[model samples]
Target: MPQPSSARLHEFRIVSNDKIAQDIFSLVIEAPQLAKTIKPGQFMNFEVPGNAMSLLRIPLSFARADADAGTVEIWYAVVGDGTERLSRMKPGDTSTVLGPGGKGWGVPAECSRALLVGGGIGVPPLVPLAAELARAGIPFDVCLGAKTASELVGESELDALGAQTLSVATDDGTEGHCGFVTDLAAELLQQGGYDYVATCGPGVMMQKVAEAALAAGAYCEASLERMMSCGFGACSTCNVETTEGMKGACMCGPVFDASKVVVW
Candidate 1:
């Protein structure tokens, strides 16, 4: 079952911002009131002023919430009108955000070892989840894949959290390894110590990661991407067919177990 969004709009101030890559922009959204309750695996839908190209709420994963700082950070790749609008927003620009939506990454304190995998724009939400695992003193590893080495984001930040970051690229002659993030995942799983695999990326990439995890007998989870409207469960745009049946990413998930996702 899917749920509706609790907030119609959350007033936030952009305190600081920067670029992580060609299309990626990271922003610090000041929203003290919401940060306190935001948990890992959650997202916020934003209302971008209607422009000529598109008119719909853009729902993005909640990258990180600095509760103490009264701010939250989200990394988005400028692909279309909504994201382009968000990317153009400068410091002090006011934004209307909604949610803490979906059930985010599942990080169990007692789990043996955790592996986080991210690809392209899909990598944003997992950053904070990695940070949380680090805060819990949980030994974890992260494998990130992108087209080129320069495209990889949050490596240093993840490292600061004590995660052994593995960077991979398709060109092979780049950085850590030359292959898919799923390739890195297979190599790590070979070491044979992981208890969980959580990921977000191109669905094709995640499907491969999930396959690898399933082969290794590790628990796996993932956040999904889809066309959305209503920012909540009301619209059925983001529904996914699972083993149990259909579920909405806007309500029941943006994140779900790898076992539940129906790949087609």
Candidate 2:
């Protein structure tokens, strides 16, 4: 398991904030220290201004980090009050963030090839992971899912990163396959070349990916999502049930061995 990194408050200035897809927004923030230190699959807690009653910060995983440029990009959906407020922030907006939190993907050095599965908003974290795999010269295939074509994110980005193959699925047949991405994943796993698998998405999606990876005898890791009330382990709201017992998502994970996870 990868150890959690210490969290700290960093002041950030929004470089750009734009709507990229239906209900999805892309936010780029300039925070040099954080940009240099945050790892793929780890999350950050953003303190969005404008809400006094909503004291808890918004915990989000980054899509990409440009260390040299001193910027970090995040993709988020406006599903709630906090996110709605977040989407309204304009460029040059400033805020404080607590981050470099939680353990990230632990792909072994021996991994020759990888399969990445992501759905909807969960696709953000996997973008950086794909880049890492590509940097290491480990070929990877991607399976993406969304409700419709307009809502899909990261396919083009992942393809640009040199993914071996990119497959997409939509619930409504507005895009590639007209079923769950799990179906695509299962088909790919059946061919038997992947040595490692990583997924982030809806609980059911990750659960199915975990099952398929296990069947294929591939080492798999998943970025689990939970309501992280605190970006640290102080609040027990993000506990995850595993074979070993309970663990906090904010510290012990946002990523974990898929086989050991007992609850999605």
Candidate 3:
């Protein structure tokens, strides 16, 4: 009941197949139909063509959605089997992509100023959200964490969208900031004046942002990365424990109010 039982596998094209870093890729998917409703934190379930070896689907986040162009983007890193196969694809090659699925960027319009934090592959999805914020005349800041300078994915796009692109690395002499992205996020939250915070990245990074937002009395929402078997709610692997109980990340979230999630 979380989403339609099934949707057609619309067209999929790979805009960029080059590795941003050692294991990262900027894979952009073009799904025209789904673009209209695609939101900030939402994700899509994709079926890379010529693959009968894996499970039913692979879920990817809604990195960016352009309705005018009739396409949705997924800036993903080659993680495992599914992603690695996807990374090898080129433009005009089709994929059985079915979505705009999952809980979307829970960016409330009531808040005018916010912070968007992403880690390596996590940076792409925030680009559309930043663009949305820009269209709304809302100001936002962005902090991205990568192991090194080469791993940073969407710097130019984020900058073009009007987000004050704050890039960080484990090494201090790299770019904008250094150390864990969580540290940069912590500083931004403590420095004050943000209405809310939105984060999508590694779970630990999102958790840190949530902690900072909670202590500061500002709302925080996160998009999580989980192993989802059935991109819809049929499989339970994507479920996470929350204050309200367990909710499936594929359905109830890819995005959730940090306050509702119970971190053990």
Index of the highest-TM-score prediction: 2
Compose the digit string of candidate 2's lDDT tens values, residues 1-264: 435457899999999999999999999999999999999999999999998899999999999999999999999999999999999999999999999899999999899999999999999999999999988999999999999999999989999999999999999999999999999999999999889999999999999999999999999999999998987888789999999899999999999999999999
Question: By descending lDDT, how would the candidates be arranged?
Answer: 2, 1, 3
> What overall lDDT, based on C-alpha atoms, would model 3 receive against the true structure?
0.76
Best lDDT among the predictions, by candidate number: 2
List lDDT for all candidates, in order: 0.80, 0.95, 0.76
Error of 3 at 217 (Å): 1.4
lDDT string, candidate 1, 141-250, tens digits? 88888887767787777777788655555445466677778888887887778888999999999998898888888999999887778767777888888998888887
TM-score of each: 0.93, 0.98, 0.90
Which pairs, if any, clash in model 2? none
What does the lDDT read for residue 55 in candidate 3? 64
lDDT for 172 in candidate 1 is 55
lDDT of 3 by residue, 1-264 (tens): 255533445776666566656687666666677887777777788887556777668887766777888776666777778888888788777767777677777667689688988886777768777887888888888888887776777777778888854556544546666588888888888988888888877788888889998887788988877888887788799988898888888888878888888852
Per-model clash counts, in order, read 3, 0, 2
Q: What is the lDDT of residue 106 in candidate 2?
A: 90
Tell me the spans in candidate 3 whose CA falls farther than 4 Å from its real position.
1-8, 13-16, 165-167, 171-173
